[model samples]
Target: MSRATATATGFIAVLLWALLALFTVGSSPTPPLLLNTLCFGIGGIVGLIWAWATGSVPQMRTVPLRVYAFGALGLFAYHLLYFSALRLAPAAEAGLIAYLWPLLIVVFSGLLPSETLKAGHVIGAILGFSGAALIISGGGAGLSTEYLPGYLLALLAAFTWAGYSVLSRLVGSAPTASVAVFCIATSLLSFPLHLMFEETVFPTTALGWASIAGLGLGPVGFAFYVWDIGCKHGDIQLLGTSSYAAPLLSTLVLILAGIAAPSMTLLWATLLITGGAGVAARASFSSN
Candidate 1:
């Protein structure tokens, strides 16, 4: 896909994730655990199909199973923390705070052999982190107590994502299958956890299925794979930086769906974030 198209796809994936989170709010019959598990289970299947569709899975022959094994481990650990964070935090808060991973990627990427920190990178990181902080803490102004736990969870999610973002780069050229295989494996890991904590499986509901499909196909299955591919060929900071756009699109979807309302403060905060993301994307890709 072209850069614009891929970016749009990524943004849409994040928006879908946000929507899934919103749908979970007033669910009647399904518990969050089973619903989440079903979503991931379905996502694993979708990722497999998507990798096949894009010819990413077949590329595995060129990459060693050992490296792919590492990729799988990274993917599993990342999802474990991501899901746990969601259970602990609010969607908007977790989503916004977790947006920091791109900046984290830059910081970590600097330690890599060829990566360099440009002035744009530093400036962009500040703007991005500040904007994300504002959104999570409350309207880009100050922090609030009620949302504290959510902010922490989101931060942890960012850490998990950043770690994977960095480590995936080390795997170098591993086909998309590595991530897909790991996603499927990690998804299975969570199912047992779900069963252990929950009483019963979720009944089949259209809304329930819809949320599962969205989470799996859009975010977990597709986006994660796309991200891994980018990590394979592109600068992690660039791909991660462009991710700031996801929350902007996601928050807009939330507003349009009446799941959440927008405010002047949030608008400004988004400006900072999206602005930083643009700068960072441009800088990271310049070397390409």
Candidate 2:
């Protein structure tokens, strides 16, 4: 696919992730590991089915074992650190730290071969991060010293994801079908972890179940597949900068659903994120 098209495809994952907070809230009371197992299980099954139908399963055989291992570990490790961080620290602080991934992606993408990191990209990333920080922290940036471990884990989670995204480009030849294996492998890994550490509680209500299904079908499922394509072929810098929209859009989703109220914070976040994306787009256009 064209770079622009692939980048657009990758952005779809960001859009789908906008619903992540809502679905996660709806799927609550279920432990993170169990939720991870269930969501990835559903994602894996659906991905396998789609791959089979589209005759993409054969393509996965040609992908190296290390590629499979890397993809699986990358997905599993990020969630593991994120969940662990939240367990140890306040959600808002931990989430804000974890949300550093996008900014890291923009920075790290600069190191990639043939990719130039322009001043606009850096400025845009900072602007986007400021917007995300406002939303996640509610305009405060205080982090408790007692939660040092969690903060560290959250930082690692950010690096893990950004590294996973940037490194996916190194293994750019891997087929998107291989993400099915990654999801299944992640599910398999999560199952043992859940059994070891978490109680096996299923969702209590229809809405809870629907939420999990929605997460699997969109954010946790197709998002990864398209993201692989984008990271490998699209403008990774632009994708990174645009990802700040996920949190902004997520909050808007919550507001629209009546789960949250509109605020000045949201309004300012909207402008910062929009302007940041616009600046990054201008930079990308100039480069092309």
Candidate 3:
């Protein structure tokens, strides 16, 4: 794909991710690990079906096992750390820390071959981070020493995701169909974790089951595939900076769903995140 096309594909993931919070909220009472299992399982199955239909199943055999291992471990580790962080720390604080992946992606992309760390990319990333920080923190008093472990875990989660995304480019030759295996492996790993840690609670409502399906089909499923394409061929720095829009769009989704009310904080966040993305886009155009 052309860089522009790949970048657009990657941004679709961000759009899908905007619905993540809403779907997760709707799928209430399902423990995180269990939810992870179900969603990944569904995503994996659908991906496999697509691979088969497109005759990409054979291409999967050409992919190195180590690549599959990396993809699976990356996905599992990220969720594991993120869930643990939220369980141990305040959600707001933990979330803010975990959300650092986007900025990290922008920074880390600088190290990639042929990529330059432009001033606009850095400035835009900072602006995006500032906006995300506002939405996540809600102007609350910041982290406490008491939750140090949780904060650390959250930070690790951020690094895990950022590293995964950037390193994905190194394995750009891997077939996108391999992501199905990653999803399946992640689901299998979550099974043991869920069995050990969480009580089984199936979705009791239609909305809950529908929400889980929505997640599997959109955010957790196709999002990853497109993201792989973007990271491999797109403007990684611009993609990273624009990812900040996820939170802003997510809040807007919540408001539309009547789950959240509009506020000044939301307004400011919208401006900062949107403007940051605009700046990043302009920089990307200049570089191109």
Winning candidate number (lDDT): 3
Cα lDDT computed for each candidate against the true fold: 0.63, 0.76, 0.77
Residues 1-288, candidate 2: write the lDDT tens digits. 799999999999998877765676677667778878888888899889889988999999999988999888998888778766765654444555676676666667766888888888788777866775665564565534577777678779888998998897787567878889999999999999899999898888999899889888988898888877897899987786678666567667877887666667666766665566556556655786
Cα shift from native, residue 18, model 3 (Å): 1.8
Candidate 1 lowest-lDDT run of ten = 20-29
Q: What is the lDDT of residue 285 in candidate 1?
A: 66
**Pairs of residues clashing in candidate 3:** none
Write the residue-wise lDDT of candidate 1 on 120-237 in tens digits.
7778778877877776667745676676776676677677777776776676655566566666666666667678886775546777556556666756666666655555455445
> Model 2 misses residue 163 by how many Å?
1.7
Q: Which stretches of candidate 2 lie over 4 Å from their true place?
A: 1-12, 81-100, 132-156, 226-244, 273-285
Clashing residue pairs, backbone N/CA/C < 3 A, model 1? 43-216
lDDT of 3 by residue, 1-288 (tens): 799999999999999987876786677778788888998899999889989998999999999888998889998888768666755665444555566676666667766789787888788777766766665565444635577777688779888998998897787568889999999999999999899988999889999999989988988898988887897799887676668777567767878988766777666756665666556556655776
What's the number of clashes in each of the models? Answer: 1, 0, 0
By TM-score rank, best first, the candidates go 2, 3, 1
Clashes of 3: 0
